[model samples]
Target chain A: MWAIQLFNGLSYSSILLLVALGLSITFGLMNVINMAHGEFLMIGAYMVYVTQHLFQQYAPAAWFDSYYIFALFVSFTVAFFLGMLLEMGLVKFLYRRPLDSLLATWGVGMMLQQAAKMIFGAPNVAVTSPSWLEGGLQLTSVVVLPYKRLFILALVIVCLLSLYIYLYRTAAGRSMRAVMQNRDMAGCLGISTRKVDRITFAIGSGIAGLAGSALALIGPIGSSLGTYYIVDAFMVVVLGGVGKLAGVVFGAVTIGVLNVFFESWLSASIAKVIVFVIVIAFLQWRPRGFVSLKTRALES
Target chain B: MKQGLGTINRESQFKWIVYMLILGMMLLAPLFLSDFRLMLLAKYVSFAIVAIGLALIWGYTGILSLGHGVFFGLGAYGMAMYLKLEASGGKLPDFMVWSGQNELPWFWMPFSSFFLTLLLIVIVPMGIAYGLGFLTFRNRIQGVQFTILTQALVLIVVTLLIGQQAFTGGSNGITGFKTILGYSLSDPTVKRVLYWITIGVLALLFALAYWMTKSRFKRVLLAIRDGENRLRFIGYNPAVFKAFIFAVSAGFAGIAGALFVLHVGIISPSMMGIVPSIEMVLWVAIGGRNSLSGAVLGALLINYAKTTFSEAYPSLWLFLLGGLFVISVILLPRGFMGLMKDGMQKIKKRRKREDANENNIDFTFGESKR
Candidate 1:
């Protein structure tokens, strides 16, 4: 029973880690709270839904084995483009005013939810896991590990590695890191901080979209899917301390484990409240969170 | 200094006159308006009181709490508990009984007394806000992070309220109040009196807030808003002031919540969620942040529009509200008062330039074209 719970908890944390990565980068670099992130996830889910429909209609049955691979492209490109558009159009002007950006992004989120509702109708939309992705690994009696969850776990690891490589190895990543450290200094050094910001925003949003598509494999997708995860994502980012990848991993695992343990005794809603209280108490003890960085922003 | 004091006295008298005119209008409103409309105004006024508290913290002091709905919810629940107990005639509430609760919970015992209920309503929210503010301020959690924590508070409270069905009446929330202190709530006279009470509280709180904003404490608050570290450098404890204002605002919200339950005749977990909390901020934003009159008027106007639009066009209303938020933040950053102040300045300038452009076709337009 403990193993089953642990496995489930680990997969849950994997999903959380994916969403938190985008949020951490956005917070650490842009310092703008992107409330519409969840909506981007919803858009990704819907994109997967659309791609699946297309695949069923025109793509060969043999090709159907790899529908999610195509779905990934669909979700990522659409979400990335939209994120860039949002940044250029709205979020860019409000960079100096974090409070305004928070509210404005929330407003944008509401509109996105309404737009999704108008397009998809006010109901949960289904996106099926491919046939081969179905079922579980029969480890032993009472210790079965679900294959869908395993797939998610495997995909999360791959994405994390690719993200690390993209962030640490590439020139764009280096410049992005430069911009994150100090925008004015980077701009003076002849780097187009504007381009770096646009790319970072797009990639962050794209990750959220990918996370959303992954979400569809486990559960039904709806306009509110983003709202549900957005708070948890913030909690993870906060508890881990902003700008630390390893912090996110640790936070996710701790939260995931705690939630599972609490769920055994308490109702889901009660468990949620308990988790929130725990986070609050933890925040009280360590306001800068577990991995506090000595940044110029922290002094203010 | 003498001349300044004289002008201040005259300005205060002018404010009193404005207050009287507004109060007179509210007092005479029941005669002109239908009971339903009057009742709606009463509800909106109750909301306006919450907006005033929000204005005190967010506008002047710069602690943008995103979870004030929790405070308001506790106030409503406190009132609801009393009303529920009164309706049940000292037994468990109907829902509790229906859900198989035999013994009366100890918490529900104190709520049986009307005065005690009111006291609890004020103190509980104030206590919660004080505790939260102390922790946040002591730890130096300010700005965007503090706002997010408050949002988390809303989620937590809402979850607990919804989960504890027997106590909180679950998602359905505590409702079906038939009377208050033996006065049948169905009676229009009682409602009118309640409306008057709400307006009375709102006026008194508004005055109190206005007075605070004029005092030395207001400077400390504004300083905290601008830079708390600087205030500390100068040898002042910013945390005390922040926590105090937070508690005071929470108290205001709590009273407003009780008045809200009385006016609207319902209090639910749904009312205390993130949406309502954000809407509370919207009221201050739309009305004119930092202006008491603006907060009150903004609350009344926004709620009036909300009801009218939602009733007339349910499908389009959410879009309208969302669009208003985006437009208000992006376009009208200072809100309605900012626009009004700008227009007033422009008019003053126009008067000075009128002699130069007297022959123009359109006075306002031609001045702009020049």
Candidate 2:
């Protein structure tokens, strides 16, 4: 029983980590709070829904189950382009003002949510998981691990590994890291800070999209789905320490474990409240969070 | 220097007259407005009170709380509990009975008294704000970190409220009050009285806020906003000051919440969630954060606009509200009041220039005579 609970906690943490990564990345890079980050995730989920419909209508019967792969890519690409467009049109101007960016992005988020409501109607739209994801890996009579969760875990691992390579191995990643370390110094070294910011923000948004795509497999997608997850995602980013991947992982794991542990004894909402209190209490001790990078930049 | 002081005095005098005129108009609004319109105005005025508190903290102190609705809700809930208990008349609230709560919870015991409820309305939110502000500020948490923490606080409070259905009426929240202090709530006369009481409280708080802004404390707040480290170096504890102002702000919000409950006749968890909390901030942001009058005007105008817009074009309202947020932040960072101030300053500057040109000629004559 404990093993199953632990697995469930870990599985939940993986989803949280995915959602937090995008927000942490953009926030770390630009000091801009994109309140619309969640909307991008929603867009991604809707894309999956769109893909599922297209596959049913156009694709061969045998190929229907394979549409999940195409949906993930489509969601990521669409969200990425939209993020880039938003960066250029709205977020770029508010780069210097973090608070203003938060409000503006929130406005953008509201508009997106309203737009989604108009397009998809108010009720939650269902997207069925592929047949291969059905059933569980039966370990014991009392404990059976779901295949869908295992798939999600695998997907998360793949995302993290690829992200790790992208950040550490690539030249663009090097430039991105330099900017994150010190924007002025990076700009002085002839790196285009503007381009880095746009790409980084878009990538973060795309990550959110991917998370949303994964989410569609688990349950129905609604206009408010993004909002429901956004706060929790933000909590992960904050508690893990902003701008640090390791911090996000640590935050997610801690929250997921604590949430599950408390949930076993209490109601879900009460458990969530407990987790929030713990996060706030933890911040009282470590205001900079668990993995704050030492830098000379006073404002940062 | 003497002329500058003279102009400042005259400008302040003009401002007071305008304040009085606005107050007079509000007092006389019942004559022209129907009962429903009067109720709406009262609701907006209560919001204005919340905006006033927001202006003090966000505008003056440079601390933005995204969970102010938590404090507002606390106040509203306090009032609602008292009213709810009174309505029940020695028995448990209807929801409590329905939920199979045999006895009133320990927390609900104190709210049985009307006076205690009123006191709690101010004190409870103030206490929470002080505790929260002290914890975060003492830890040197500011800016986005502080904002995120407050947002989390809202989430916690909302979750807790929703979870305790037996105690808090769950997501439905505390409502269905038929009377207040033995008076029928449905009576138009009672509503008019409540409206008057609300305005009176608002005016008193507004005066207190104005006085605080004009005091030496305002300079300290501005200094903290500009340079907290420097202020600390100068021997002033920024945390204490920040926490105190935050507490005061929460107190104002609490009062506003109580007033809001009276007018709206409902105190639900949804009203104090993340969206409503942020919307409260929006009022301050759009009105002009630094000025009390601007904050009050912002709350009134934006809420009025919200009601009208949503009623007229429900689908497009969010788009317009969103556009307002973007436009206000990007184009009018200082808000409508900021724009108005700039225009006023420009006219004043032109007048000063003409006055200076005349003085220059006179000075030249004096030099020649000497």
Candidate 3:
């Protein structure tokens, strides 16, 4: 029972980690909070639903099941470009004012939500899982690890690995980190700080898109799906500490475990309240968050 | 120096005139409007009370609460419990009986008395605000962090209210109230009385907030907004001040919520969720966060526009609202009041320039004659 619960917690954590990474990165690097980041996830989920319909109408029988793979790439690309557009059009102006940025992005989020409602209608639509992921791995009569959960875990690992490579092994990534650390020094060294910001924001948004696609595999897609997960995603980021990759991972795990544990002991709604209360209390204890980086800069 | 003093006196006189004009309009509204419209106006007036509280914290203290709906809802619930009990005539409320609750919950006992209910309406929200402020502000949590914490608080309160169906009437919330202190709620006279009561409360609270803003305490709030660390160095506790102002703001929201329930006739969990909470902030944002009158005006104007727009073109209202938010943040950061202030300054400058030009022309003409 405990083993299965742990698996359930880890699966939940993967989705949280995927969603929060983008928010944490952008907030830490640019000091801008994108309230519309969840909308990007919604956009990605819609892409999956769209792709499913398209494949059903036009694709050959053998190629139909492979539509999920194509949907993943499409989700990332669409969200990446949209993120770039938002960064250039709106975020560029409010980089210095985090609170204003929050409100403006919220406006953007509202518009996006309205647009999604108009296009997809208000009701939730389901995407059928591929036949390959139809069943679970049975460890015992009472213990069955769903293939869907395993697939999501694997997807998150792959995303984390690629993000590590992009942020560490590449020159552009180095410039991005340099800008994050000290914008003036990075600019003086001839790095285009604007370009770095644009790239970083786009990448973060794209990751959210991937999270959306993963989420679509687990549940029905709706216009307001992003709204449901957004607070939880934000909690993960805050609990983990912003800007630190490890912090996000640890935070997600902690929230996920606590959530499952509490749900097991109490009713679901009560468990949710308990989780939020704990996070708030935890914040009171360590306002900077777990694994927070000590910095010489006063404002940070 | 004399001219400057004269201009200041004139400005003060102009401000009083504007205040009186608005006050007169509110007082005379029922004379012109139908009963239905008057009731609607009363609802908007209640919202103005909440906006005033928002202005104190967001505009002056620079603390943004994204979950003010929680405090508002608490006040509404306090009033609602009393109304429901009165309607039930000493029996279990219909929903509670349906939920198989044979007895009244212990929390519902205090609200049976109208006087206690009224007091609790303000006290409960203020107490919660103080507790939340104590927890976050003492730890020096500010900015986006504080905002998120408040949102979490909203999530907790809303879920608990919904989940405890037997106690809170579930998602439908506490409703079906027939009377208030034995007066029939459906009676037009009662409604008119309530409307006048709303207006009185708004005027009294508005004056109180105005006076508070002009006091030395306002300077400390401003200082905290500008430089908390500097204020701390000069020997002041920013946390206590922030917490006190936050509690005071919650008290105002509580009053607004009670008045809102009295006018609107129902309070639901959906009303106090994240969306409505954030919308409360937008009212202050659009009205002019720094000005008290602007906050009231914002609550009235935005809500009126929302009703009219959504009524006429339901599909387009969200788009317009979204666009207004973006535009207000980008171009109207100081809001409508700030724009008016700028326009007044421009007119004064243009008049001065014209006078200087006339003087120069007169001097040239005299030189030519000589």
Candidate 4:
């Protein structure tokens, strides 16, 4: 029971972390809170739904097993390009004013959700896991974990690792770090902060796309699925300490475990209430977030 | 002393004119509009009250609270609980019974009395805002962080309400309210009276808020908005002031919620969701965030446009709203009031320039004659 619960918690945390990392990167680096971040995830899920339907109808039966992989790539590309377009057209101009960005993006989010409803209909779309990833791995008589969930967990780790490398090892990564540290100083040093911002936003949105693809495998897709995750993603960003990768991981795991344990003990609603109470308490202690940025000047 | 006395008399006359105008309008509105339109206007008046509260906080205090819908929701639910109890008349509300609740919950008993429920409607939201402000402001949370925290609060409250279907009436929310304060809500006469009462209350609240803005306390709020650190250096604890204003704002929002329930006869969770909260902010932004009258006018105009546009072009309304928000943020940062003020200034300048040109022409002609 403990092992199964642990696995469940980790898988939930992995998905949350993936979704929140995009928000954190955008918020932490650009100081812009993209309230429409969840819509990106929703778009990715819709893309997967469409791709899966197309593949099932047109492709050979043998290629169906690898459809999930194809969906992820397609969704990522679509969301990434869209993210770039959004950044260039809207977000870039609103960099200095974070609060306005929040409101504007919220408007954008509503438009996207309404558009999705108009196109996809209001009902939730049905998605199926690949045949190999279906069913559970039975460890004992009362202990079973879904294989798809385990796959999500593995995917999270791989994605995080690649993200870590891309953020730390590459020259662009260094420039991004510098810009995040001090935009004016980075600009003075000849760094193209605009280029870095666009790239970072695209990558962050791509991760959200990946999260959406994973979410389709786990549950139903709908126009407002993003709304459900948005609050949770914000909580993760807040709890993890804004702008820190490690904080995102920690926050996700803590919230995931607490949610599962509380749901087991109490009703789901009560568990969510308790989680929010905990987050409120946590915020009271560290308003800036769990991990404060290294530069003291950025405190404002 | 004579000049001061004259100024005082002038101000009093101005106030009387304004009061009489409001009284006349309120008395005359119900005569012209149908009951349905009267009810909608009452709803708009309630929203105007909420917008007034928002103006006090966002316009005066420079704190944009994204969770005001939570306060509105709490107030609505508080009144709904009372109305539902009265509707049941000593039995459990239908939803509770449907959820297998045999007895009335102990906490819900206080709301049985209309007076106590009205008191709770104001108190509950105020209490929550006070507690939240005490925790958040003291910790120095501001900017995007504060905004996100408020959004989280909205989410938690909304999710809790939705999930606790038995208690909150779930996604459908509490409806079917038949009466308020023993007055039949469905009766046209009763609704017309309520509409007058809403207008009166809104006028009184607006007057009080306008007076507060002209007070010394409001100066401190503006100071804090401009430079909290500087205000702190002058020995004012910004958190205390922020908390006080937050509670006051929530109190007004609570009253608006109660008024809203009276007018609409139904209160849904969606009414207090993030969307509505953002819309409230937009109203203030478009009306002129720094001006009290602007807030009220903005709320009425925007809501009117919303109803009209949605009715005319339901499919394109979202895009229009989105575009409005984007355009207002980008171009009309100071809002309609600012635009009006700027226009007035430009006219005065042009008039002065014409006077200078006329003087130059006259002087040159006179010199030629000499």
Candidate 5:
């Protein structure tokens, strides 16, 4: 039973890490709150719904697992283009003013939610797991692990590993890191900071798209589901420390484990309250976040 | 020094006259307008009061608290709990039974009394704000970081309210309130009286805030807003002042929420969500931060426009609001007040130039005659 709970915690943490990583990068590197980050995720979820419809109409006989792959690709592409458009049109002007950007992004988020409602109606749309991903793997007489959860966990690890390599190894990654540390200094050194910002934002939003696709597999998708994850995602970013990739992973794991333990001990509502109190206490101890930026350079 | 004192006195007397005229209009408004319009006006005034608190914190103190909806919600819920209990006639509310709660919870017992409910409206929000401010300000969290934390706080509170069906009325929230302080909420006479009471309370709060701002305490707040590090180096503890002002601002918001419950007769978690909090920030932005009168004017004008726009073109209201935000921030950085001030300065400059030209012509004529 204990092992099952532990696995459950890990599974939950994996999902959270996938959802929050994009937000952490955008906030840490760009200093943009991107209140519409979850909206990007919502867009991704809707894309999957659209893809499922297309598959049903045009390719009914095709393998069901193949549809998931197509949907994931479509989601990333759609979210990436939308994110780029938002950055170029609205977010770029408000880059110097974080507070104003927060308000504006919130407005964008509201508009997106209302638009989603108008398009999809205000109901939870069921997303079926593929036949291959169905059923649980029984580890012991008392312990069982769902295939979908395991798949999500493995996917998150692979995404993180690739992200780690991309951020730390490549020349483009180095330039991006330099820009995040100090925009003016990087610019003075002939680095195209603007391009880096646009690329980073796109990647961040595309990850959110991937998160939404994963989330749809686990639960019903809806217009307002983004609102549910936004707060938790933000908490993870703050607790893990901003501007550090490792911080996001740590934050997600801690919150997920704590939530599961609390839910087991108390009601779900009380568990949320407990998690909030803990975050608040954690913030009190480390206002700059648990992970400090290695370089002390002001970007804005 | 004496002349400066006299100028200040004259300025204050002029302000008093304006206040009296506004108070008189509010008092006589119900006599002319229908009860429904009067009620709508009262709601606007109540929101203006909340905006006033927002203006003080965000406008003057430079602390943008996006979670003010939480404080407002607390006050609304405090009043709703009392009204719900009163409506139940000493029995458990229906929601409690539906949620499998056989009896009212211990924590809810105090809210049954009107006095206790009112006290909680003030104390509860104030306590929460104080605790939060103490934790956050001491840690020196400001800017977007602070804003996100407050947003997170709002999410937690709203979710808690939605999930706890028994205590908080779930997603539907607490409604169907009939009376306040033994007066029928449905009765027009009671509503008129409530309107007058709200106006009186708002007037008193304005006076208090105005007086406080004129004091040395306000100078410190302004200084801190401009340069907190400098103020800290000068031996002032910025955290204490920030926390105190935050508490006061929250208390004012709580009062506004109480008034809102009396007027609207319903309180929902939606009222205190992240969107509403952002709307509150917009009110301050459009009005002119740092000016109390501007804040109230901005709230009334923007909300009035919203109501009218929503009625005329519901589908396009969000687009209009978004456009307004972009236009206001880009064109009128200091808001409407700044634009007005700039216009007045230009007029004054043109008039001065004309006067100087007239003086030069007169001198030439005098010299020619000599």
Candidate 6:
């Protein structure tokens, strides 16, 4: 039972990690709040749903087994481009005004949710996973690992590895890192900081979109699906400590484990309340989050 | 100096005229308007009360609390508990009985007294806000952390209230209120009385908040918002002020919640959730977050628009509200009142520019347009 629970927790942590990565990258790099980050996830889920419908109507019977793969790419591209457009149109101007940016993004979130309702109707929309992704790996009578969750876990690892390489090894990634460290200084060093911000935000948003596609495989998609996961996603980012990838990993695992364990012991609602209370108290203890940024000036 | 005094006097007079006009309308509204409209106006009045609290915190102190619904809920629950007890004829509330609770909970027992209930309705939420504010503010959790913490607070309170089925009515919430101090709540006369009382309470609170804005304390709050470090260097602890205002704002929200229960005949966790709390922010944002009058006016205007739009074209309501949220922050950050204030200031400035070519008349707070 404990082993199964641990597996469940780890899978949950994958989703948390996926959500947090996008938020942390954007927030750390730009110091701008994307209150509509969850909306990007929502859009991604809708993207998958739309792709599945279109494929079923137009594609061959043999293609049904791999429709989700096409959906995944489509989700990422649509969300990536939308993120770029939003960054250029609105977020770029409000980069210096964090509070206004938050409110504006929240407005965008509202509009997106409303649009979702208008287009898809208010009911929860979902798509079935491919036959290859169905069922679970039965290691033992009591230790069954679901293939869907395992696929998600594998996706998380792949995304994390790619992110690590892109952030640490790639030229653009290093320049983005320079911008994250200090915008003016990075600009003085001849890096195009605005381009860096736009790329970072787009990448971050695309990751959220990918996470949403993964989420659609596991559950229903709705206009307000993003709203449900958003608070928890934010909790992961904040608790993990912004700007640090390791901190996100640490935070997600801790929160995911605690959530599953608490849900097992108590009711789900009570567990949620307890988790929130713990996070709030933890915040009091470490206002700079689990791992404080080395730059003391920004902490203030 | 004489011109400065003259402008101050003129401004005060202008403010008094506005207050009297509102007060007169409040007093005579029931006589002129239909019962349904009077009831609607009462709800808006209660919302205005919440906006005043919001303006105090977000506007004056620059502390935007996203979980104010928790405070409002506390007050509402407190009032609802009292009303439930009264409705149950001193027995267990209906939900408790249905949930197999035989005895009244210890917490619900004290609410038997109307005065005690009223006192708790204000103080309990304030107490909660004080406790939370002390930890958050003393730790210097300002900006986004503070906002997120408040949102977390709302979620915690909402889930707790919804989870404890026997206690908090479990999503159905504490409702079916029948009377207030032996007066039938459904009675039209009683509702009219409640409406006037709500308007009176709001006006009184507005006056008090307005006084606070004009006081030395307001300057300190602005200073804290602009430069907390500089204020701290001046040998003042900013946490105390923040805590005090947070508690005060919570108290105001509590009062509004209680008034809301009286008007709406229900108190549910729904009113204290993330959406409702965000709606409070929108009210102040639309009113002009920087002005108390703007806050009240914004609440009335938005609620009126909401009801009108919902009744007419329900499909367009969210779109309009969403647009308001985006536009208010982006292009119209100061809101309607702010725009009017700017326009008024510009007109005043232009007039004074002409006067500069004549008598060079410009002085005091009201004359800053020049």
Best prediction by DockQ: 2
TM-score of each: 0.95, 0.97, 0.96, 0.93, 0.91, 0.96
Residue-by-residue lDDT tens digits, candidate 5, A129-244: 67888998988876878898998898899889988898999998898888877778999999988888888888888888988888888888897778888888888988998767
Docking class of 4: medium
* Tens digit per residue, CA lDDT, model 1, A88-116: 98889898888888888888888888888
Q: Candidate 6's residue-wise lDDT over A185-293, tens digit each?
A: 8999999998999999999999989988999999999988787777777788778777778888987888888888898989878888778778778978887678756
Q: Is candidate 1 or candidate 5 better by lDDT?
A: 1
DockQ for candidate 2, C-alpha atoms: 0.70
Which of the two candidates, 5 or 6, achieves a greater TM-score against the reference?
6
lDDT of 3 by residue, A1-300 (tens): 789788888888888888888998898788777889889999999998899889999998788879999999999999999999999999899887788888899889989989998999988999987788889999999899999899989999999889888879999888887888888899999999999999999999999899999899999988788887788887887788875678889888898888888888897789888898788789888887786767787666
What is the clash count of model 2? Answer: 0
Misplaced by over 4 Å in model 1 are A296-300, B1-15, B350-370
Location of the lowest summed lDDT over 10 successive residues in candidate 1 chain A: A291-300
In CAPRI terms, where does candidate 2 land?
Answer: medium
User: In model 6 chain B, where is the ten-residue run with the lowest total lDDT?
Assistant: B361-370
lDDT of 1: 0.85
Off by over 4 Å in 3: B356-370
TM-score of chain A of each: 0.95, 0.97, 0.97, 0.96, 0.96, 0.96
* Clash counts for the predictions, in order: 0, 0, 0, 0, 0, 0
Residue B111 shift from truth in candidate 4, angstroms: 1.9
Please report, in order, the local distance difference test score of every candidate based on alpha carbons: 0.85, 0.90, 0.88, 0.84, 0.83, 0.87
Worst window of 10 by summed lDDT in candidate 4 chain A? A291-300
lDDT of 5 by residue, B1-370 (tens): 4644775698679878987897898889999989778877888888888888888887778888988899988988888888888877788887887888988888899998888888999999999999988788897887777778888788889889998888889999998777776778899999899999999988889878888888998988887788887888899998989988988989988988888888888889988988787777778788887778777888888888988889998876766666666666656656787777679767755664586588753322233332
DockQ of each: 0.65, 0.70, 0.65, 0.54, 0.44, 0.60
Tell the DockQ for candidate 1.
Answer: 0.65
lDDT top scorer: 2
